[model samples]
Target: MIQLQSSAMQDTQLVSNMMYFYSNSARSSNGRQSWILLLPDLITQSRQQTRVAVLATSMLLLAIQSREERIFVESLGYYCQALISIRRQLPLVTDPQNPDFLPLTCVAIVLSFFEALCGTLFNGYYQHVQGAVVLLQIQGPRNCALVPYHSLFYAVRNHAICASLMTGKISPLAGEPWLTIPFSLSKKSSSDLVNDILLAMPRYLSALNADETASETSRMSREDIVQDLMNHLQNLAGIWSQISQHEHPIAESTQPTIPQSVELTQRYTYDNPYHAKVIANYRTAHLLAFSLLSIILPCHDWDVAPFLDDSASILSAAGYLEECDIGCAYFQMVFPLRLVAQHSPCATRRRVAIDMLKRWCGEKPVRGLANSALEAIYRGQCVIPQSPVYRNVYPDMSTEHSKACCERPVPKPFSYTAKGQWIKLDGMDTYITGDTKAQRAVLWVYDIFGFSSQILRGADILAHSSKEPILVIIPDWFRGSTAELSWVPPVTEEQQQKLGTFIQTKASAAIVVPHVRTFAKCVKAVYPRIQRLGIFGFCWGGKLVSLACQGDALFDVAAQTSPARVDPEEAKHVTVPMALLVSGDEDAGLVARYAENIRAETHVEMFPSQIHGWMSARGDLNRLVVWNEYQRGYQVIVQFFDKYL
Candidate 1:
């Protein structure tokens, strides 16, 4: 234990001693524990060292221990390492590709699982696969003890996927109430959750694919992948729910969440030492089942490009990157099939599919689409009867007034148009159109809510600003899945490319600002004589707008809320104006810091609260409402546009 800093300590002696200790420990190895005890505790050690060393140590230690010990230690190491990496610095964890954050080791818990089981008549709930992994590091040790917490997190976040939620996947009414019974995972529960979720997903995808197919191929459509995925999700959900919750369903009425005889299997049989190994097997299954379900359920419900994109956003929030990647691949795979479904006109199945997607994406169509299937509920043509939102301070306010919509005759906003169709910068069909509308045009953005779609609470800046001859830059993939997109087969790569390309074409709506340098070109092209313009965006689009404005002359005014990315240096570069809108309850501290950085460097409007979907839409979870109470963001947007745009 000599000090490591001294030059004289170029210590072969230390290495020799460590090796001796390692070898001796093998003689009476407590397995992983003995090895760990002999070494510098990796958990407490500083992380200037490479991660391979940590993985290597854990792998070898696990090899020496009992199955139970090995599994637990392995999980512990992965979780610890994941936490460590997040705490240390790296680029912010907004993008999935960030290296400081991909924690495959923690994902070890979900490697294998037997996702088949009878319901114990109970229930379920997973977040950010990228930055969330880091946030979970800051989440501290609450759920880090073993596999259960990760399993719980995975299940909770992916509750829809786990149960195979059918909303937005089938006819919206297919599972309107989700169940005939009051299904609860606890005494407070009762539901046919498993069945409803599984059934709704494929039904919707089938409808989507069927709608897109030509009259000839409509009759010849092949395998039902939506049903297949739902079955898989149901199987996994039932099995893991049974095991984790300790219940088995012998009755048809009982839709158990875990597996039958599960706890015993995981606990011990007194049946044999092999019981422990069996426990490891079950633990592995439990973890995998939950993780996969988290990913698959949301995907199962929404195959439309907008919904798929939304699924990605939800996955990022739930911290299911591995699942997100898998979901993205699946989306690519089945894309073609769904496209065919979407091609069909006014078929009952297609209608069902659209409804299901609406539920999942929290999309309640404001206006009816042109398709006959949606004719019954079409609100697009008719002025939708504004639903009254209940609140504490104000008398119940209608959603119409609650949203701070930008004023009509929105002063000319800065406009930029792109030459080609919207090209996907990162899986979005983004188009920007702005030309000397305001001294500087300000843009409003959202993740899943596109300009043409229903409004999200107070986020009607685009629609409400009908008076303003503003150039509206609408990105194609804002919602990930939309009514138009649902009809496309999202399972095929060719289809994905085609659809992605089509969406990208929308960029022709405005000047294509592909790179930071080209952005200035867009500004120059649009505002050769103008002096100011503002840029605004939401969700993924919000992130994009924020990034695009970084140190560029294209945007004179900018407002990004619920943004996915932030570049602080952009503050110094931004010459004109900017603002950030955030509301509801979720924390925007990280983004707020960026805002502060901007304020430190320049003046910008900023909303320090959480507005779910920027009050652009509603968020539904197992029927519980989170952001159904407000719609003032629209008003805020309107005011911002008035002041800056």
Candidate 2:
């Protein structure tokens, strides 16, 4: 390690290393406007504090590059000295005319990156950028149009937006003065244009994410905020379309085939990864805006197809960049890829994005920072209700208070064991309980969260009816392929993708319906003493129960709770009495249609406050309200079965 001296600053080896780091790791491929290009000159001309800060940043990068404990320890020493120097100089460098202003601001930006590299200092990055934001404001936006100042301003603006995104707070630089004044003299780049639009978003997000403590009159109407988000989505789409039109006109002539898998498709050829990088950024921005829209505006029944299409496009672009093998370009795609992993509803796309990010963690320069971001993703912090916009923002007391009131728990409770005995019903493992000699029998169908103890307990409760005991059998229809509890809330990208795949492949109507019918036949064959038969289903099982009830000879009556795919056309074929118990998550309009069309004696009850799967495996037994609802749902099922079966 080189000793800290003025001579060390001019050492050929040190200078070469610093230059390489800046060129490859610090700056994007578009280096013309990047602040990093000014570092070489600043190192020679800046004051002691500025010089030390730059050196500390270089040393940290070197330590990371070499993975040397000694180098890292040495870097820490310089970093502390640099911090002290900055604090000493900060009070005096307030004026833009002060010789140290530009260099100090640059040093602050460097420290922001330094904090990001440490990763342990989660708030340190934002704090440093916040100081720089203040310095930039003091410098005035007009003066920022000059040579080095222009570059520094851009750096500050970018860092500020990133900090704001992670914190879910409005960027101090989000106002119109900063947006228009800085770009008045110099024309903005295509990337700058995109960010300029994004800079306008934090204010809206902050408002939309306001806690319940926030005064109702103080907040903007949700409808108005939604309108703004819609406009932003459209504007971002337009910018991306323009970029496509300008960069790949010939390829853009035809509509590109939407990707259905993780495989990279050569839909549009890029001369360089930078073009793909820009496209991915724009697409992610649009997708994030749409995701927010979907969460806040639940009634719109927004077609998830376009949202998925954009996700696929993002993956395609990222996959293309990975093939290009340009390390710097890969960093450019980091934000976009993270967005896909956090926001994309498609399981395949989310899994692919996560895998790519994991691969990049070892190869990227900002490995610590990347790892920290991945930690947040794995923790399922990014997909919480109004997330991805809120990204890694930790909730404060107010935020937590608001969340507790409205939000459903992630990974809703699943009991590990069931009370009933497991017995084979003609070769199929079934949860059998209650009186075997009873006249009535119920074939219980579980949801995608197959055979959880909650559902089994509900079955137990239904079976042990004191006045009229009935035989209950819950066959293992999923055959151990039940949706994993980890994917309940589907927080992480991989989990989301896994859940999606499980639904389509394992739990789909086409695959599960035949097994259900077969299970019903097997149950009847095994329990020949039963005079009448009934079927009860929960969530995905409810959908299958509905399908099975369509002129099926096996069941005398049917009931479902939190049912899926409630088509009215299928209701007309229901040959027996049917009960529909649903949560707020289901489409009431569709449920209404089923009731209107059903020929059988129909019982429709809506638990509007409860989440879907409340009566099944996803219910949180810990919550008193949810537990009450869970008990009531089973009681309803019992009464309906008693009356008809």
> Each prediction's Cα lDDT score?
0.33, 0.70
Q: Candidate 2 regions off by >4 Å? A: 1-12, 24-33, 211-218, 245-269, 295-297, 319-332, 383-645
- Identify the leading candidate in terms of lDDT: 2
RMSD of 2: 12.1
TM-score attained by model 2? 0.58
For model 1, how does the per-residue alpha-carbon lDDT over 1-645 read when each residue is reduced to its tens digit? 233464223223333333342333122112212222223333224343223333333332232222345444554555445445534544444443343222332221111100001011111001212223333343333432233233223222222232222112232223443233122222211122332333344443443345554464233223344344446555645544643332211333443222221221111111222221222223322222232333334334422332222222222111121112212111111111122123211122223334433332232111111122222122111111111211111211111111222111111112223322343433445554433343344344444335433232233344345345444444443335532333133335444444444434532113333542354445446545545555666544555565566564566666655444344444454555566665433234444455666642333334444333433333321222323222345455556666665
Location of the lowest summed lDDT over 10 successive residues in candidate 1: 112-121
The candidate that wins on TM-score is 2
Where model 1 places Cα greater than 4 Å from the true spot, the runs are 1-438, 443-446, 455-470, 475-520, 551-554, 563-577, 588-594, 600-611, 614-632
What's the number of clashes in each of the models?
161, 1
